[model samples]
Target chain A: MSSSTPHALAESLCILTLKSGIWVLFPITVVMIMVGILRHYIVLMLQSPPKKQPRAAIREQRALIRSQIIRATSANSPIPPTYYKSISQHLSQAFADGTYLKDGPPKGDAPAPTAPNPLTDPAAMDGMMAGMKTQMVMMVPQMVIMGWINFFFQGFVLIKLPFPLTLGFKSMLQRGVETPDMDVRWVSSLSWYFLNFFGLNGLYRLILGGENSADSSRDMTTPFAAAANIAQPGQAQDFNKLFKAERDNLEFAEGLYSWVGKDVDTRILKKYGRLPGEVPR
Target chain B: MDLTTSLQKLAAYRPKQSQKSKETFEKGVALLEHGGYLKQGDEGWDALERLALAALDQDNLEVADRCLELIAERFPGSPRVDCLIGIRMEATESPDVVLKYYDELLEADSSNAAAWRRKVSVLRKMGKVDRAVEELSALLDTFYTDVEGWLELADLYASCSQYVPILLISDAQNLMSARYTYALQSLSHALLLAPQNPSHFLQFAETAYLAGDITLSLKMFLTVVDMTDDDDGDVSPSDSIPTGMTLRAWFGVKLCTRRLLTEPRLLTSSGSQTPAPSSSNISTLDDLSTERLRTAYLDIKNESPPATEKELIAVLATLIK
Candidate 1:
């Protein structure tokens, strides 16, 4: 490649001269940042506030949450295995009794897969719509800005990253460029923009608060990463399914062991008092 | 008048590194006795609290005992008397006996928030944190508006926090919802209930910093710096906070500022996901003063950070000149 002139090799520094791609960095940055900010606003606007559920439904969700919290908490909870066991038994019975569920067992035939059918439940539909909205917000801007970058600023190496990477990344990062053996550090304008698109959540936090809708720190939410499954609105929460899962979890849990212990950090902090060894010199 | 005035100053000035003279407290007690100001009222209670605290500071357990005696004798039915008795028990009796004593007082007057607070403190001092958390939560259940209870609960949970993963394997989508760190959850509640707490701000800052929310952490750290600096006259009214949180908050400020500047582009670009802002505190967090954060950061960067922040100290030393 013409990049490796004899005199250039003689300089021996990683820094290489480039063209207007350096100038293009600003436009790309502005675009990605704008997209990120726009995405937050869109999500903010589209977000459906949680609907008021029946008292029974609320109680059921809370019971499940309490169980989940306890599971998370037991890692450090001082409550003995006996305490957990009692709690588990109480929860298990509550679930078995169907005490907190809003809907009751049908005239016969094993409670429900439910009447209006959870697959068509309005609440379930709302969740799916919310999920779709988030996906749309993320995808639409991504496509538009990506195409815009491809059309306007195609080829030219931007700044070198501080970290070194394998030569394999050269093709991925310098896509529009065809200089074989060009320094892998030379990223095209589109690649630089992509970098900013994923990265600027922190800066946005600096400018806006962390909770700002525009802070795309969530990055690309893959299906694998979605925290809640947005079922079709018709689909209701299956308490039976939840109960079975909890039964499985409780069976596997250490709740039966039943001896209370001190939280280790509490014990440590008690011993050290203030920031171990932080007594003013 | 002279004695009561000195006692009030002593109460407020105890945060000074220099120790107070025993004579100041002794004279205050004598003056209160001689002037007959030891009756149940704001003056009497303030003087007694100051005297009791000062005597405790001087390790004059005898004097402390006498002060508690006068408070109880005069107040008779006051909840503050139970608190004083609790403090007295801390000095005199074994913690087991004192805990029982506080529990008895609580059984009598379940509505006494002061007694509840004293009970929590005794539990904390005894290192029964699980019990302490329960008591604090009980206090929250009955008196949800009690910001102090929430703050204590948040602190306890923060100390006890350990990241335990949930097996959300039933659905891959469930995996997307990052587990809210329990400490962060309680702290968020406290912030929502009392947005004015500076210590909670510090706690939020330190916790956020630890959790890799650099922007939010920086914002909270800067908030603490602004609040502390703005009220630079006296030891902060933030009596709930121990000296420990201040140390952490200051350390967090130093660390977060450096991280924010060092890899502004890199940190923002890296695919690390910030947990969703489940806390309303973050949702309400608007109009953050970046100018103040930057300026205060530069100013704070010059000072010596705590020994606990050893990593940041090294980074600070090599920071851009």
Candidate 2:
């Protein structure tokens, strides 16, 4: 019994420290959850309804859909030969004439022009503003909370984890605490704040359902995503070039139409075991 | 059933246009007044929408108004709710009033697809089919992925072909042909949008038959039959009769084959541009379709009540001969 006295004292000391640490841990966690919920509502309110495209833009898109249909169906199926001929001819002609282009036919034989500057386009500017607004909504609360944790709870050791960790984790788990001899399992208040920031993602999903904007981890990747979209600006493609490419594709598919549709009636009859010459497999 | 169970059933029920709307309305009203089952959860909103439509169908304007009011209060300024209000008004208002309402909705939000479709339908209901066609075409230009829109356009064109004034025979023929050509074009779009559904192929085949292209019609009919074959090997060879859609396709095949046999001119004329199947092969297909149809009717006669046999035999006689 005398040999166990020092061990008991050390265990009790650990428990006393952990009990004090609970104050810091509990408040930071609660504040994080509340801020996440508020941020979700704020983002929802900030989102704008999708804008409608002009009639010419819609026509340009659907004309592409029509050509895509012809290309897809003419390969393996039995489209009536005359129907195929008329549709393919009409589409190729429309593509060549630039009838479906949003701005109508090109003005002159000038070489393909450079893409318009994104900063000059009002629509592109609006998109950039919207993206920035969402980023600010996500970042401001995080930065404020991080600064708050660093200011007041600077070196408070919040909790001691039950499992043992290597010496490498001492720096991560005791962010502001300066005791080099302390156990790696003792998590300081600032480290606790960071943990709650990332680890409450599942909790947010539970409270707000699957598609809520409360997730902070997703914001980590948005900067890279926005960088990729910056090149496209307003997603304005060159419709004349697309239409010409599609026309070439449809012209190529005309051969497929002729080959597949040549003996459609006979092939169908034979497949169904109606033709006398061959038995259906 | 107990109140809770019956309410659950009502919540799950999705009423189609051809269902017994009056009965559905009564049941839904009873549940709403007594149990308050429709005040719960997301499914409750769906049930409310269905009940509201049923109320409109039954001409219970008061109930429809109450339902719409509740839905609007819950989802304020929702485009779906706005469309529901438009539908409720369509039950009672003049076509012009309803058209104005839809136009107002469209003006507020120009991308409201339901509002655009309703406007076209109102124009059609007022018997201005040409105007309806023009509006629907414009709508499809924006909503190119709307398979229902394409189908509705095809139906409108086919209906136009039906009502040609026959006094000017040559002009009527030209107009009829042009209408059919447009209908075929629309159906082809629908087919492309939903390639996996067999019904579009069936519709295309029937339209081809109506357009006097017997060979194309026959080929399309066979395509439908092949598409719905299942090939699960669950079919016992002795008792097998193509059921449902396949059965319908077989009947279409029989009709097309018989027509071609009687009017060989149709086969030659349509087949001149493409290679026509030998006449012998068409007769063979005709025999095969007739035999399959006979066995199917016989199977149905055995499975059905005895009283239906006389009627079934009468139908079979007309169809087979």
Candidate 3:
């Protein structure tokens, strides 16, 4: 029984050795071989010719040697430079002739030119003033309405309504406010609030007011009028009238200003004796 | 007969509620004749009531239709019939079917802007953005004051990055709505259109600066500065300034107007492109690198300056070196 026990133990040890070999040793060997092959392939893909490196190294060394030689040779000789004074005299002569003016006092400061007057042209100035008058006329009613609204609801709330509504309903119309009852009326009120405050009314009005003001000022100025006339010759009068009407009108305002601006070419041709594609001087 | 016996005999003789199909039909006919379903005993009102009841009871659209047909036959010219048809069609929960009813409504009344807007919304929900846009554009063409339609088209163009169309429409409307943001976006796209224009590069620089993209702005500015015809001995400040402006004269002033006090060094050797610092504060000054250079430039660009030559020189030495 003792002998048989020893034999069985030996057999078990042999099996254990085989199992560990299969599990660990075999896979590791395979992995190592795969990794080695991959490394080789990557190296091959990245390989460049050795010729370029050696040539670059040689060139660098040559440049270093050349610079050293030049330094050494320059140190060996220190000669008296006779031609320097003659060169300086010739440069001073040329500097005086070319740079330093012979006519004016040397270092004289001249007065600067005056700013150009834009309103000098009588025709352009007259047209601009006319346009200005029209704009003022158009704006009077709007301004009055605005003032009335400002007085009623405080200035801020009055500015909150949509453009055409604000203009149309100024003092007469009382917009319905929502109460606990009437769900439809409440929903509409909420919608109107959201739309007027955040949607576009506030932003649109701000931009419109700014643009109208700028355009009004530009139309009324002589330089701008002259430039406009030059840009579109015959429509100067129409432009003036249109600008005035757009700027001043509170009650019945349209996108006439924008339309006229966009169609300036056509309007000029129709009104004045200007042709399409005609260049303005 | 005795009283008790007579009562019993009468109870037996009297008919119970009718058991035959014919009798049941007669009962229903009587109810109908008496106007059972009608709310106000109006002609067409009863049909809608019956239809609503049929729809509720059976939970089937066909039954609802049968009820509708009875009403339509009874009151041929009734507007309520059309409204009832629309209600039933909408109850189907199918957009196409609902749209069919809306189309009928439109055909009956062309001035119904509400119906048109609803149709457009349904089309948009179905991912028919182009179709919705077309409908809205048509509406806008007829009624230019329809701001909702204009806004919708603008939104569509923006989402699709069809900027030229957006610009064209906004210009036509005479509104610079989202003009700044749109201009910034267009400036970026313009680079794609003309990759080589120096003027375009300058515009890109300005727009990027405005949009708060400092890195892109700096790169664009450097690109334009490099492209000009004037070739200074080095990439000098004189070379960077654009030509044909009184602004060009101001470049020298800007260069000499740094806030920080430092030194400018002239190159002792031909290979050394940068000037050496002559200021005594050279030991304390930060080392020259890309980041330091950029920070220094930014600091100098946004500061109050001294007008005199001596102060300008001191400032320049600090900023440049």
RMSD of each: 27.7, 5.9, 45.4
Model 1 agreement with the true structure over A49-160: per-residue lDDT tens digits? 6454443454555556545544554443323233345555776676666655656532355644644644466666677667777777777887888788878766656777
Which structure among the candidates has the greatest TM-score?
2
Q: Write the per-residue lDDT of candidate 2 for residues A1-281, one digit (tens) a residue.
A: 56766646545555676777788789999999999999999989987776777666767777888788778877764466676787789889988988888778777776786777787878877777777777888889999999998888887777888899999998888888776666788888988887888889999999999999887767866664643454353867888888999988998888876433346556656765665686655
Q: Rank the candidates by TM-score, best first.
A: 2, 1, 3
Off by over 4 Å in 3: A1-281, B1-37, B41-109, B112-115, B140-321
Report how far residue A89 has shifted in candidate 3, in Å: 71
Model 1, position A4, has a per-residue lDDT of 77
The CAPRI class of candidate 2 is acceptable
Per-residue lDDT tens digits for candidate 2, residues B241-319, read 7777877787888788888888988876663154456788778877777666767776766654223434544576554
lDDT of 3 by residue, B1-321 (tens): 443332222211211223442343344345555656555455335434343444523445665665677677776844445545555655557989878877876776664444555566666666777777677555443333333344455445444333334444545322333333344433433332344455655554454344333323333444444444254345433223334221221222122212113212112221112122333222222121122233333455765455554564465455443
Report iRMS (Å) of candidate 2: 3.8
TM-score of each: 0.38, 0.86, 0.19
Q: Write the per-residue lDDT of candidate 1 for residues B56-119, one digit (tens) a residue.
A: 7677788778777777887686555666666666776898898888788767755555666677
Considering lDDT, which of the candidate structures 1 and 2 is the better prediction for this target?
2
Candidate 2's displacement at residue B32, Å, is 2.4
